[model samples]
Target: MKRCAALCAGVGMLAVLAGCSGTPEETPVASSPSTIGTTSAPAPAASVPPAGPLGSAAYQAELTKLEQSLAGPLRTLTRVRTAEGLTEAMTTLADSLDAASSQLADLTVTRRLTAVHEVLQDSLGSAAETLSNSDRTEANARCGGVAYTSQKVQRQLRADLSGATVPLDRLGLKFGGTLPDPGPEPKPVRPSNGAIVIRSGPTGTGRLKITNGTANDVAVSIVTDGKPPAKPHVMMYIQAGKAATISRIGGAYHIYFKSGADWSPTRRQFGEDCSFQKFEQAFGRNESWQVNLEPTLGGNAKTTEVEAY
Candidate 1:
């Protein structure tokens, strides 16, 4: 019963969820008895300069950019429940984390404020690695790792000289399941043929029912055309032999499911004619659908109409 409408809409406000050093200075080159006499100066104090810099105004600006980079990707990573969605979201998240972690290493700060930055660097990196490399069946179940890790970075926003507040409050970010948590891990659903995609958006509030019948897990991608510049709006995860609900959705859109790896060999898409606007108007208000993946004789997934409400 993990719900939807939380990805980019933001019922209230904000957003993921972090990152080098210079070589040691040559010991004040001993005069080797030659330069030592050059200056009537006391022998230069021998010391190794600190490796990294402390936080600064410039550092704060860099934090701001990292904050922005993390917002969309973190939200997507937390909300997306499908294998493909997880893969896509993690891919995006990893890119942002990679940027943050890499940049964090090179910044030359005074006093070396490494603790906070390292917390974020490790969290984002760990979360991204889990999503990117974990087995497909296990990826969605591991989303909790992404949530709490990013939340740690979120809590440090205002405290940091960056003083990141606006983004922190939005998305209603929190820990311990304040955000929707996927139910018990589901069994993999495998559609012998291919899965189905049904696009819908209820006028006010509506729920979407997606059922995956096969033994392998299926991931759903929903995109809306209600406004121009259509983008991926919501993503759902349906485990094998499991049914999940997208409790809230509003607008017009189409969806496509990544059945088993069978579709990996070729690309597939849904037509605009399938927009739920047609049905919402025809049926008036509340609209729901049952998307079932039926296997085909060939080693492929085929699209078919199930039922709509």
Candidate 2:
């Protein structure tokens, strides 16, 4: 009986060991292919192109309109003939430019057109500044200078907007108007024969005896020797082959003479066949001097040709 029990126990132990050693089914796991020797490529980045002219039309129209508005003021400004008129006209032009600049600020333009728009804006400002900064005294002296400045500003603006992309006009751009003609040539003032056209300064015991041996009429100017030199202290005219005396001349002075046909008082110069010369030596008060208009060999006084004073 003990032997059978021992054999049953051994059989049970063998069966348990066999069950523990038996293979069991497992759940399948998801996986990709081996990545050790593989690489992933990223997608390409997107690109955007520059805008074309389709977006530029509206901005161009606005700019063209703005440019046209300046023509009236420019016309008025350029038509002015006097300094006072120029001052008034320049103020008007500057105001117009200011208004244009304000309008420009409200505009919306494309990237390429933005550069052109900024150039226009800058030109307007520059023109306004130029008008504002003009020297009033100089303007009064030379109205032509004012016209020149205006013309220069207009030319620069035109040149700056000359690009193909610029909106010159729906038709064409007009910046300023026609400049007025510098009036008719001033009529020459011809003094009578042997006339003293001008005489100034304190009178003294000095005197001058002038002899004209040439065929043409001669005018002699006693120019004062001082600051702002060449100002005439006494001016006298002598007919051909005539003699004249200038008495009561005062202070130190130089002798200048011009032989010509027509004498212009405003220009202080002769109109035709003008020849200007000045004696090298200076003469003082209370001295009597003699001058010969005819050129002489071995002359005591030296003379040189000088510019029209």
Candidate 3:
């Protein structure tokens, strides 16, 4: 109220100044409360930004419908007792999924929620495939596949919704609260013709993390030729897009990786004669190190330098 009064006072003073400057003749000033109507007019309103299509009543209603429709499908999916029953449940689920996807397909709101639709589609499609597996011998593979895809999708949905997600009251499945736990990552298959191992230098103590980015299997090992370390060197096998961590006793060391018939070595010996800054100098403690291997010429593997810490 005080601020509004001050603003009005400033406006009135400006008006009085303008009135005085207009003419040499004396002009009657409207200063009394009775003259308030002639003195000032209401201030114009501040403009508000539009909320866009996502904020539309129709879009929010669509979301509510989607959340509600999942109830019957969720109940069916969670109560399957046999493979045939599972198939029937998935048929219903797939239909619900199709309907949900279609609702958002052409809408501008779908752009931000693309991940939600992808998760729904993947879960439905994989569930159908999982239940269609007739080979008893491949039961584990079928179960594993479904578990992997569903777990990842559920986790993503949980993260996307955060904790305040609305729950499906009828189905008892809350978006963020009812997500399944993450399953262990599947092991990568090493091709028959995988990368071979090159000879490693002597080992030393430190932390060694190896990342294989090339399209081959890499056999990495830590070696120390300097001070007799407390921990022995360990060999790590990593596939493409995978990594392995090893503990090394602190000392000067070298890294070696082998791919195919070629044996390549890291150029620098870690923790060897080189010294760190006074503050960074190791105080009877092992410093952390990471080595990333990438494909070089013909078939050799070369280490890449990247800041990992």
Candidate 4:
């Protein structure tokens, strides 16, 4: 009876094991452990949209930015005092303008603004070429006067910018008022080599003879040696390699002089390459005073550069 009971129990355990190992189609199969909690696949990355063409306002704003970038460099170029300095400044300006033209070329503009953009780019390129190809000798000659050189460059830049005026105005864009005008050129003086202009002070028997041996024309002024320094008593224009004498009686006074090119009689100064200087020594009353404008080795008189009046 005990053996039959043990055999029946073993058969019952085998039947339960067969039921757990049923066929794939009849069984409810479980997911793998790795994918137990997963619900769906990962999403794809988002893409950026393409930029559209610039409108009128946007195009104008871009042009204004370019102009602002160039203004400072142009002003700096005008302030350079020497020929080499002017050349360097002009090259820098040309480089800046060329870069600006390239930037404009890269911009995408609407159909209406396309023509305007081309005009601006062409103007900038042309101006840059003009400056880069300027004659060095001409640039040096212009360097004689800061004011004269400044005026010339200002006009040139203005003319170049003005080439786009018609197109810019047609589009109702801002133009023509960007660059500041440097003013008109002064009239040239046509006085003789020994012209004299007596300004002020009482007449006297004193004589002043000026010998101008330098390359530039010179104007000499004899001023009273007062507590605050009085106005010049007598003025004379002596051309280069010439001499002039002013005869009159006057008290002790100091001598001041200016030299340069393109003398403007109305303004009483040179239009370019100007310099002002004064003798350190003072001449006494009723005497003959002689001076050589050019500096000489072992000279007795001392001169100092002074500010313009």
**Top TM-score model:** 4
lDDT of 1 by residue, 132-240 (tens): 4545323322322333323323333223322223232232222112222344322323333223333344434544565565665555655565432123345554656
Clashes of each: 31, 0, 12, 7
- Cα deviation in Å at residue 32, candidate 3? 63
lDDT, candidate 4, 261-291, per-residue tens: 7776655666556777787766667766556
Candidate 3 per-residue lDDT, tens place, 1-309, comes to 000111111211110000000113322221111111111212111122123334223344554555566566656655555444545555555455444444333334323333343344344334323333423312221222333333433344344434223322222223322233465433444432223222244444456555666565545544454422222144455665676666544454555343331211231111111111111111122545444454333321223332100
**Candidate 3: residue 83 Cα off by (Å):** 1.7
Runs in model 2 deviating more than 4 A are 1-189, 227-230
**Top candidate when judged by lDDT against the true structure:** 4
- Candidate 1 vs candidate 2: the TM-score winner is 2
For the record, the alpha-carbon RMSD of candidate 2 to the native fold, in angstroms, is 44.8
Candidate 1: where are CA atoms >4 Å away? 1-56, 78-82, 137-309
Q: Where is the poorest 10-residue window by lDDT in model 3?
A: 14-23
Error of 3 at 198 (Å): 44
Worst 10 residues of 1 by lDDT: 12-21
Number of clashing residue pairs, candidate 3: 12
Ranking by TM-score: 4, 2, 1, 3
lDDT for residue 60 in candidate 4, whole number 0-100: 66
